[model samples]
Target: MDSSPHKLYHVHGIDSRQFLEHYFSDEPDMAFGDDLLKFPIDSLRQLFTVGHIKGDILIDLSLGCFIHHLYSASEFFKNIIVLKANNRCIMELKRWVDERTGAFYWGHASTFLQEKEGYSDQFGDKEGKVRSAIQHVVKYDPEKENMTDPLVLPPADCVIIATLLDVISKDQDDYIRYLRKFCGLLKPGGHLLLIGCLDTTYFTVGKDKFHVFTYDESFTRKALVREGFIIDYCNVKERTAVSDLVDYKGVIFIAAHKEK
Candidate 1:
């Protein structure tokens, strides 16, 4: 089936005028268009300005909408590293990133890089070896296992970016610990960009069920502090309500500098 056309909307809670003024002034082309989800892209643009991100190493945690943003700004990254707890996202990102010119790596958060089923689809023609080109693919369940040691990968001299991975309010402690481990993946003074789903309900993808973790700015701020990151900037915006559909509520974006 053809992929659903990307849609954009202004989520409810945020000040749309201020958000547009702060981030989308130039009217950049968004992967999901101008309406559906506006907070993430705008926040990203602002974060990119706080420090030097061009030619930096970006570690993207969530693969759905976040991947689109990374691809949208492909020219700026030196290497893009993607980690997804979800198998589908990992596969999708690997395919999308491989097609681009920059270096791309994919795997689970707890594990480094290991191949798994449903990772690659059968292709009639082989332009490049997508499977073989993968340097590392580790396998580990974030909830069940702990990443005792950081996965060894290529060194990144610049920033590390991740989003939509940690914001489950109920799992606050666990999420904070996870965030620390994620920070360890980056170099000291490296920038960490994060986008998280705020108040929302349980949603299902295939057989997997995801529960919501309602989070506000204060909670996130404290978590960042505990994780040893200096808050560069943060913004929370409510996702515009879609009639008759499950309400996503809102999302939060944070750009923090890893303390040296």
Candidate 2:
């Protein structure tokens, strides 16, 4: 591989299914699956269960079509609106939401959440609840004044963003600009949950290297504080799985509330 900067993920026509298989699949051979998938799910479950983040409407703007974290989110928020940066992600998520043929399997994620919550024989029910809670999944443009045009959304009570800022942002300033935009979507004192990788410069999706802004835990905290967020909870898990697919040092989950 040349020393060229990673190509932008959006421009590369990322394959949503391939991305999931490489990062989120539960197969035994997928070494980084636990770090990329289960870690965030577990962290989100812990944050949602701690009882500080409360809301009726929760908006998710995550990387790709991943919905494993929403299994826990659906339990707390009555209304979930998922915003995707592209139609491919939207369509892929809808395939699962609609339970269409050939949808990617998420039973492992559902089962993990079920076991964590100490529930039995509720995997099917959990999936249904998430599907019902998600009222809409729409494509959005970050540059637009109204990201969700023709469909005005009420200010969200809570917003969850997972590994997306790194993909969309071009620099530190761009990352902070996007944070301000997210803050604008929330009500006063609304909560924000962020999931990201530490010191990661790129990720691979079907042999394509996509750029990811390199950032650290301290930088994330400072960025959040600079964007007028009061950090509430933060957890960072060290990278244990070794993979040549991506060069992430660790994973970080931060829960914060926007300053009123």
Candidate 3:
């Protein structure tokens, strides 16, 4: 039997607005709102508050233009470097940073984070803080030996990748290879915070389905260990919301550090 028609994120271009509306929107009915937004934001809030992940530079290589987690991250890391797989994503993110017209509104996300952290107001400044903390937004080539060719970034103190690997990786080997590349971006003992799904196969954006590598929690731990990372924290949230856009069994948050 033929599988559903779909596109590979690494090859096919994405519609940034459609992608955000489908997966990252704050609408209560959106299937992935909790899994993609609230879960990671909560986890990052705790992790950053514990005082272990702070640094001068934090590299963000997440799946799309989402920045909910960065509101918490900006408070800890002085400089944020965003790396994207395509220029479209880069431009979309830049639009938000520059406060350009038609930029996707993330106020709902900021409000969500603030409420959780016991802040009642000042929602207006959330974007400003993230924009100021964001030092650079650059494109990266995952196929290149140096993901950021011609722009050698100093090894970061921390790297946060959310829902990116499973979409970009085709197989277990590809997962390991990309994990190694992510490791290369961190300094010795630098922390790596990864957020993605477990046992997922596909996710839809707009009208096209996109591939998501199927892997469970154990495989992820083994992959990180093999890539020279010492796992420090891991959390998994079973599928709670219902949706046909993606068939993910659960969401996962993992924190690890490169072997010093």
Candidate 4:
């Protein structure tokens, strides 16, 4: 039950790089099946295309690998702050942002977004936009009851979270508590873009497996409402693969606003 940093790769997708291509590609595969990436990015693509989100300050709650979804935030936000729960995630992000050797290439995903959003056909435009917009990458501990207990961050106009709640929380109450704590960092009426898994008990990165809090759509909506959020947009996709490596009912994407 030890959720140490060393074992976090089991939850953060470091254990499985091959499955990552599917998360960013429009292609189909049977072995690894579908992951939590493509669907959420598609949902975000829709949300950002409509101009529903605009802000100068945006905070990313988790350093989701291949977060080309940042293409959306970079388009509007002047500053982007990524808060990571695990040091490894932060290091990986820095690797790409700094364009270090052996870093996972993100240009393909960014180019896909630029073309999809009709911004630019040239990939570097979107890539530069994101690279320059990213202002900070710091470690964040969700286990801290007071989310800002140690780090004093400015209230953000928008916050983006993915796959953190389900894997981090011990149970429903812990999930709700963390949700409330994170929402407190958002300014009143600020926007929130969240993505989570549904009815999943566990998942594997490579050789290791990690636990997840299984919850349904109803639970997600209620949790948002309980945390004083007004739902704006929501999308849910049924799990396509039930292999031993990955098992889940679905993935949910919600764009909500903190009630003023």
Candidate 5:
């Protein structure tokens, strides 16, 4: 629609179930408890499988629906700081966190994660732990020079930025700039967990179309390395499910660290 960057990632006010289901994987083969969560779940598993990724602070710089990976972090980190794209998303997340009425139905994802983590049939316990682990829900403005102005948070031990990178950036330079900004927020030797859509330049939500920066695995790795992140592990999933909204070819997950 307008030329300004779209705030599609707001977690609140949207039909979370329908929206998430559609975006993640709406195909018959990739429905609930299916392929949509595969890469992310596996990526987190890969992260922990190596060794402990525990830290005091874990920041969720992910695109709107962040719960997909939150459970994995909850098991390791003590506190989680989540950044929202807009007030709606902030409010939406708070509703769930506070157990208020009209909150999005996240039980599916909660259960999905529980099953992934070997806590099958313990959805309530998983949900409670996730709720406890998430400490702060901060608002983020991509245009601001100081994105988190008036909020002086401790540098995070880890920053997990997914899907947002493809949408918030208009060019390679912008991606690099954002990466550098995020990297600056981490403690030395801290890690960055990134997930992105490959070869995608646009995505649609209902009737509205949003922009995404198209790139591949090589570009992603080079961008991270150029922005001062060391590669720890990376996995790329070939595009399988077709989407009516975006024409992305694949998804990639990268775990990296910034050396002192």
Candidate 6:
């Protein structure tokens, strides 16, 4: 249990190297060309192959940098459903994806499309025909959130992929409950792909702030098992040189499939 900061940092560096090797290696042929985009798509590819995903509804719970990667690789996906708390991220994703595949975009603040009608006014001053492909945007509150709420979702046939699941309290029990609620969003045998800080303190995104629940592989795996997901495969990768301004250093990649 050597928790010395220097020792931990060194270990983190080594783990990060290993992760880069596995993610960047060309031999696997599944390697994503960009370093930033590799892990999410690679993990998704693994899940798709292992779980036999095809022509299935895919949902991204939070739209971050990974959302772009998802859209770029959308040809391989059956249908893309994206969810985000930020209006700007949703709009950007919508604009980008619509330019490529005519896929719609939705956010918590603006409705690009509601039902069959298109809300072109919502996307003011944008070029190109606002495709019916764009969907409604509604307000999302992670606190007191449930998967069963009709107003909060699209359909049950969606695979839930969340880039960050840090809304719950840090206690293990609370974390388990949050994951259960996330899983409840999908249909039976659907999959859940989660990416977040494994055992870290806090993360800063612009001026916004967030904290991790200090999770490890064993704790997360057990929680998923309790939530009715079979542990298909799990990989933990560390991030080194995260920032020059701060000494921050922990990140993990986790992928799991929902069981019937």
Q: Provide the lowest-lDDT 10-residue window in model 2.
A: 4-13
Error of 6 at 76 (Å): 4.5
If scored against the real structure, what TM-score would every candidate get?
0.61, 0.96, 0.96, 0.85, 0.87, 0.61
What's the true lDDT of residue 194 in model 4? 89
The alpha-carbon deviation from the true structure for residue 214 of candidate 2, after best TM-score superposition, in angstroms, is 0.6
Error of 2 at 75 (Å): 0.6
**For model 6, how does the per-residue alpha-carbon lDDT over 94-200 read when each residue is reduced to its tens digit?**
55546655323322112212211243444432222222222433334445555323565644454544434643335677677656766677777776667655565
lDDT of 2 by residue, 1-260 (tens): 66877888655558899998998887988877678778888998988898777679999989899999898888899999999987888889999999999899999898887787786966678899999999999888888888888788889999999998988888899899888886688999999999998999888887689989998999899999988889998998999887888899999999999888
lDDT of 3 by residue, 1-260 (tens): 13866688878968888899988876767777777788888999988889988989999998878888899999988999999988889999999999999999898889878888887868767778899999999889999988888999988999998889989999999999898887788989999999989998888877788889999999999999888889999999988878888899999999999888
Error of 4 at 60 (Å): 0.7
Q: Encode model 4's per-residue lDDT on 1-260: one tens digit a residue.
A: 33643334323545334434434434545332234554665678789778878888898875345566687778888999887665566677788789889777665566556556675556776677888999988776676665545778888999987777877777899889878887777888899998888898776655666677889999999999988889998888887754676567788889999988
Determine the backbone clash count of candidate 5: 1
Query: What is the full ranking by lDDT, best candidate first?
Result: 3, 2, 5, 4, 6, 1
Residue 219 in candidate 5, Cα distance off native in Å: 0.7
For model 2, the local distance difference test gives 0.87
User: Between prediction 5 and prediction 6, which has the larger TM-score?
Assistant: 5
**What would the per-residue lDDT of candidate 1 be over residues 1-260, giving only the tens digit for each residue?**
22433221111112223322222233343222232334444555455544465545555554232332442233456455555444444444455436654323211210111111123433312222332233333333444334422565444433333334432324677567666766666777777777665554543233233445555678778988887888877777766544222235566677777778
Q: Model 4: which residue pairs collide?
A: none
Which prediction has more favorable lDDT, 1 or 4? 4
Error of 2 at 153 (Å): 1.5
Candidate 4 TM-score, C-alpha based: 0.85
